[model samples]
Target: MRQTIRNVSPMSNEGRNAYVIEHLTDALLTLLRDHSINDVSISELCECAGVGRASFYRNFESKEDIVRLYINHLFCEWADAYEQGDDKPLSALIQSIFAHFERHRDFYGLLNERRLIYLLKDVIIGICGPKPEQSKDDAYAKAFVAYTLYGWVEVWFQRGMKESSEEMAGLFKMQGL
Candidate 1:
């Protein structure tokens, strides 16, 4: 849903805060897709989000701040699902993540670049907590997960999202992440 951060009572600070967070998320996705992460500017972002500069600064120091918040929301949901103690929880967790990438296909496409994907993986790992094993075996697991989902989303989009989400999830699970 589109978000608006204006017209709410200033006294209801909590609601206003939520409004700003959601608003910035929508704007950031559009701006990043159009101008990319490296080119997007704070003024342009605030303009797209329809929030004032001061309000933007109040909520996010920069575009990355807003982007990080949105990623964390997805991470928290995935973590919660994985933490539910299902067999092969990591697979279940990967399923939750595939759904997320499916939603943000445009941004996921941008992450096809290896550098961007690794950067994203680091951010996600940092936010999601409980890092993977610090062994040679597990070193690439987190990065691989991020890259796989991003690439999968690109393929799904190009293929017109032909499979149902669960079907795609199952396909991803079979990949043995």
Candidate 2:
């Protein structure tokens, strides 16, 4: 999900690139608190991150790529935790997803406030949507599940996310969704 310039080779120095990525990510999120992604120039971001423009260009293609990559990184982390957990039921999975969002409420709340929550749809779909190898019915089912999950998250954010993750999972159970 992290989009980098094609010319940036994977053989580049890993440690330095990781440092640059972390700093840029933090800087971009900090700036996003007070400015739209469009309002913050790449120079401003580089200066805030204490990295040069070449580093920025080396790591990311656009400001939005930073957000996309961060969200994906967070989701991958959540996925790892979910995989390690024992309970794998539908309701439990729903609660885990909501809890993951709850754990990062500030970041998510900011996205909601900025009307950028739509960005999350891609993350969800990329993780859960149909794969090419699946049968048509299976693929359709996966797509349905992914979209339905996104719908719940969107409504939850729209409602100011007052309900606890447990309550949201309970609603899913009650509705048999």
Candidate 3:
């Protein structure tokens, strides 16, 4: 049976790529679940994965590398969802992202706050792109949407995912972007 992403298209070759990434993700999650990101070592990761440092490096530069790639790959998936007729804007994407995070909660729960912040910003900018407000240095208006999405999404996660996806979709829709 073909796999689906939130009742969307069946899985593809991209699924194989995601499978590899998920393994790397799983290894990292095991480390974080054991302790925290700070306590984990590259050597330990290699040992746990039973893959050489070279094998790890072949797939990723560092643990964080895989995390970023994972996020980017999800974005590509989100973008593809649009191609598949799910054009609901940032909120739908955010809901899917929440599901993604929930799936890898251990890894992120232990991530360096700075790295998480950067990752969030990277994703926000990737989704929002260069706005006219930013181009014109509109300050609050320029950054409002991204920052709001960034802050509140973190808040949503930290608050134990109290909000439903529809609630989040409402939040994004309220932004009127």
Candidate 4:
């Protein structure tokens, strides 16, 4: 399945904030598949997203902001699903994630190629609302879980996402992490 950001015409009916975020995120992903993020300029991104320079600036401070926001958007969707009672066995969350990644495979592939997946580890963990114990050990444990899950997903995408979601979940179960 091909997943794309909604175009401007349909996005006009969506909120302005959502419109800007979707367009800018999609435009960045589209460009990243062919060009390095450093090689992309605000003008180029604005043009690709079909928004004026002022509009882009009004929404985002820099190109990096777009990447961060895009990652946050994905995590937020997962959080929403969990809130809506999708959470059961952890495998269910893993399955939903695999499905989500499949939908945005191209963008995830570009992020993987650019070595930017690490930047999202904290964001993903934060959105999941892991228990907030303030102990040093607790912090380390959270970091370990975040990095392990994020790293696994990054490697999976880097490897072309060949495994089925159930297969991936089974591998995790075998590890007992």
Which candidate should be chosen as best, given TM-score against the real structure?
2
Candidate 3: list runs displaced more than 4 Å: 1-22, 86-118, 131-142, 172-177
Ranking by TM-score: 2, 4, 3, 1
Residue 13 accuracy (lDDT) in model 4: 33
- Each candidate structure's TM-score, on Cα atoms with residue i matched to residue i, is 0.59, 0.88, 0.65, 0.74
Q: Which portions of model 2 show Cα errors greater than 4 Å?
A: 1-12
Model 4 CA deviation exceeding 4 Å by range: 1-18, 128-140
Error of 4 at 172 (Å): 1.2
In candidate 3, list every pair of residues with a backbone clash.
none
In candidate 3, position 50 carries an lDDT of 49
- Local error of candidate 2 at 159, Å? 1.5
Error of 1 at 54 (Å): 1.3
Q: Taking the tens digit of each residue's C-alpha lDDT, what string does model 4 give over 27-75?
A: 9888888888889998898889877777678888888888988777787
Candidate 1: clashing pairs of residues:
none
For each candidate in the order shown, give its overall lDDT on alpha carbons: 0.65, 0.88, 0.63, 0.75
The sequence of per-residue lDDT tens digits that candidate 3 reaches over residues 70-118 is 6777668756755576455556666766665666565445553334535
State how far residue 6 of model 3 sits from its true place (Å).
40
Among residues 3 or more apart in sequence or in different chains, the pairs in candidate 4 whose N, CA or C atoms overlap within 3 Å are none
Lowest lDDT 10-mer window, candidate 3?
1-10
Give the higher-TM-score candidate: 2 or 4: 2
How big is the positional error of residue 103 in model 2, measured in Å on the Cα after superposition?
0.5
Query: In candidate 4, what residue range of length 10 has the lowest lDDT sum?
Result: 1-10
Q: What C-alpha lDDT, on a 0 to 100 scale, does residue 94 get in candidate 2?
A: 82
